[model samples]
Target: MKTADPPRPRTRPKRPGAPGAHRRRALPYLLIAPTMLALSAVLGYPLVKLVLLSFQDMTRKELFAGTDPPWVGFKQYRSIFTDAFFWEVVGRTALFTVVCVGLTMGVAMGVALLMRQVDPWVRVTMAGVLVAVWAMPIMVAAAVFRWLTDTDYGVVNWALGLLPGADFTGHNWFANPWHGFTVIVLVVVWGAVPFATITLHAALTQVPAELEEAARVDGARGWQLFRCVTFPVIKPAFVMVTALMAIWDFGVFNQIWLMRGGQPEKEYYLLGVYSFTESFAVNRYSSGAAIAVITVLLLLVGAVVYLRQLLRMGEVE
Candidate 1:
């Protein structure tokens, strides 16, 4: 009673717009400021330059003469948009991305499921092999694949030649565009599968065994058990990996270039290779920049779609 009588003014609550409240709200941004600044410093200038370059009519002449190229707003874009070859490249890139992503995810999921069911030692051995494969440099992997598909002495051709009534000996994998792409897809899927398997295996381990057992007790089996009890838990990880893989596969250049002996034919042109060819090979720098800009825009659209799907999944969960 005496303390109540002596009690003074009540403490005031902070308003949302108060200085302390504002600082508290901004603390997260403050913590991330240095990283944001660093990224801006590294990426901002190049991006600005690229965008500017896309609006200019730059060529080797302008570049070597040390003179600013004349501005030609959207002319490069107009040219490419009207070209049938560009559309073909776009379609090819899209199809390539889909196939590579599909194979990578399928093989990875199968391997991840196998890892979960196998003996611990066997799983460890498999993981070790995957890591070795993952750790191999892209250049080395491309070189190995090139040698394996070599027309004359490739082990792949030799091994297939031994099959009854089958002859793959001296088969030029890169001779036909379809066959060349198949080999490229195999190399891409091979390199891509290990990381995807490891990530998916890690995600699978997070799924509660109790839920799986409960579903099984209710007579859920095989695909039913997975669809009802397992897939939901790992769907987020799966979607993220698939989106990233698609983006990477869309930009694939090195494998095709290397496999085609650094001068990928017109038939092998993906977006990245097409951009490079336009810029350096053809001396059409402005056109290359326009293509690069279009590629970036496409990637942004994909990213937005991925984000929306992820957010929807989060909301559903």
Candidate 2:
């Protein structure tokens, strides 16, 4: 009877699946939490606030008139569409973006490719200089350029003084909108060069040397080798750089604001400057937000196009 009672106390082995299964399930969620938190802070908060503000009245005049934010049904949208300054600024911003993006990508690609052929020391040195220029704060860039291009006592004026028979003595670089725009473009190009160069250099390295050797073995040399082998591989990289630069320039505020557009004033204002002046100077937050929204839309389109190109290139590869 005692032996039988002892036999009844037989223990079962612990299941291997339970504790490990709990860990496996929790690990994925743990990893995902940080990214989720960052996205919530970076993107979700602003979006929620923007939607709320867009729906709000946000005007003292309405409050005084004993009114709350009536659902005016796209009234602000209509006002933006009707404004002439909006169109003018949009046109100028487009032209500026196009020029800046084109120049930045073209110059940066050439420099990157050239550096790749040089010794490692030379490559490092070159990258240092380019990155220095890029790492400069945009505000600093604009200020320095303004000084360099000033009508009097500027380096440009001094250089003109050195040149033979050049009558550029008293001409302010930003006197005209076109010159102002050009100077802004140059600053933007300088700032953008590093991003394009680094991306392109990374891409160029990924171009298989064995493929180039194969082409060389088949008598492909110089331009032929690049066209057949190197170019195809790095083309998507160029597309990405170009698209990113385009979007950056389209939403530019620093370069334009630093150039002091709308100083002397409104006739030369572009969208960024105009929007800022409206929001803070004249208390037109709705209008400013609308223009900012437009800029964001343009950037979104550029990003989409870049991704699409990348997808196509992946398929081709």
Candidate 3:
């Protein structure tokens, strides 16, 4: 047999670090480097500038003239802490966020449930209407609402006047702080409901009809069925919506600014509006920066709490 074919030799596989292996290993990082660099340029740089501005006595003059700003440390922060108006604004912002988000999500969930119970054609129509409402620009909607709540020729007052023993005709909706606040709340809730409803409806669709049927067979009806079966399945969506709405409503500016910019004793001033007024109106750039920092901190606290709850929920699951 010719000496067993001269004893064939075996070849080993290539090591991971050999030639193209190193490039392949580094490819993923290389791909992500641009995104990280862009984020640093867009977000990180601005954030650093904001922090630096907060610690300095930055004014309109210095900002425009390119002069070196004086460092003031925590003086702006101390002024904000000492000011009762700032605390009031904080409290008002908190209350407005809670109420607006609560009403928006509550009504949205209710509407989504109702949509499921309706005929297919009606459901489609309702969904279309909600989408149309959501598509409207915030400023346009605010302006329309402002006009609708007008004292002399508003449709709202005209409609309310029709109610028995009720008089809303010639009513100035923004005449008082509480009244203006209520109108703002209604406007925000109207704009917010469509998004929440659509998200909730999508989440509801993923839930198995069989699970619902099983729960119903076990005498779980209405809220009981929802609480026991539906909720557990869609909890993630609910928590996500809540967190998103909280953050959004907390920093609402355009709607309130357009409808009524901190009118009636500035009772309607949210953190965003307050910061804008401080910086742009009064030229207190440093103070405004401090307020913006505080607002972010508060939002971070809320986010932390939400994350903790989500983690606990995951553990339970």
Candidate 4:
């Protein structure tokens, strides 16, 4: 009976910390907590403040007096919605986005095709040029464009003067709203083309050559080969680039601002410039915040619709 009672239960071996001890499951979260806090401080707080401010009447006095901002409900939104100038800006923004995105994507596709066809050395040179153009800072690009289009001594006017029976000397590009818009479009396209071209070229390089050769064997050449063989392979990349270009073009402020500070009767004011002027210039903080919110919502809706359509088409393909 004593020998049988001495057969006790076996004890488990001890872990590094202690017997049957477990590691802290929150360690990973602890590691990322600092980064999460930083992002919240930088991006989240401002976004929340903007939304809150949009619902309140934030005048210069209220901003400086340290009093509670008066809540205005939808009045600010109603005013903006009813304004004809706001509608005009919306139309202009839409048109600008469509034209710039379409032209940039088309030109980039052509450039990508040319890159595929050219000699290695020529391709390298072209790539270098594109990189240089892309690396130009936006402010620098704006300054350079201003010099190029200067009414008095611009190289553009100088070049135009050489045309037979044509003279653009002293013709102010920024004086006319449409001319200014065209110039802005050109500058934006120049900066944007390099990105689109490089992305499309990278996509093209991933396409299998066998498929292209097969299409060629079946009497497809030139655009036919591209349409049948190359396009489907690169359609996803193309759609992505087109969507991104649309977003960038829609939110373009600095380029327009730097070019002429939204001059020519403020006709060149896109939503971004309009919002900036409304907030900082006129000190209508709530109205500007509303405008910004609306702009974001419009863009979000457009992006969602466009991406859905593109995805459905991709699935069908």
Counting clashing residue pairs in each candidate, in order, gives 0, 1, 0, 0
Q: Which of candidates 1 and 2 is the stronger one according to lDDT?
A: 1
Model 2: per-residue lDDT, tens digit, 156-255? Answer: 8788777888877888877787887788889889899998998899999999888999899999998898788898888988787788788778877777
**C-alpha lDDT of candidate 3 relative to the true structure:** 0.90
The parts of candidate 1 lying over 4 Å away from their true place are 1-13
For residue 169, what is the lDDT in candidate 2?
81
| Top of the candidates by TM-score | 1
Q: State every prediction's TM-score relative to the real structure.
A: 0.95, 0.82, 0.88, 0.86
lDDT of each: 0.94, 0.79, 0.90, 0.90
lDDT score for residue 187 of model 4: 91
CA RMSD of all predictions: 1.7, 6.3, 3.5, 6.7
Better of 2 and 4 by lDDT: 4
For model 1 the TM-score comes to 0.95
- In angstroms, the error of model 3 at 170 is 2.1
Q: Is candidate 1 or candidate 3 better by TM-score?
A: 1
Candidate order by decreasing lDDT = 1, 4, 3, 2
In angstroms, the error of model 2 at 131 is 2.2
Pick by TM-score: 1 or 4, better one = 1
Q: After superposition, how far is residue 184 of candidate 3 from its true place, in Å?
A: 0.8
lDDT of 4 by residue, 1-317 (tens): 45556766898677668633444556678899999999999988897888888899999898789888999898999999999999999999999999899899999999999999999999999999999999999999999999999999899999999999998979999888888899999999999999999999999999999999988898999988888889998988988899899999999998998998444257888999998989998899899999999998888987997789788987897
Colliding residue pairs in candidate 3: none
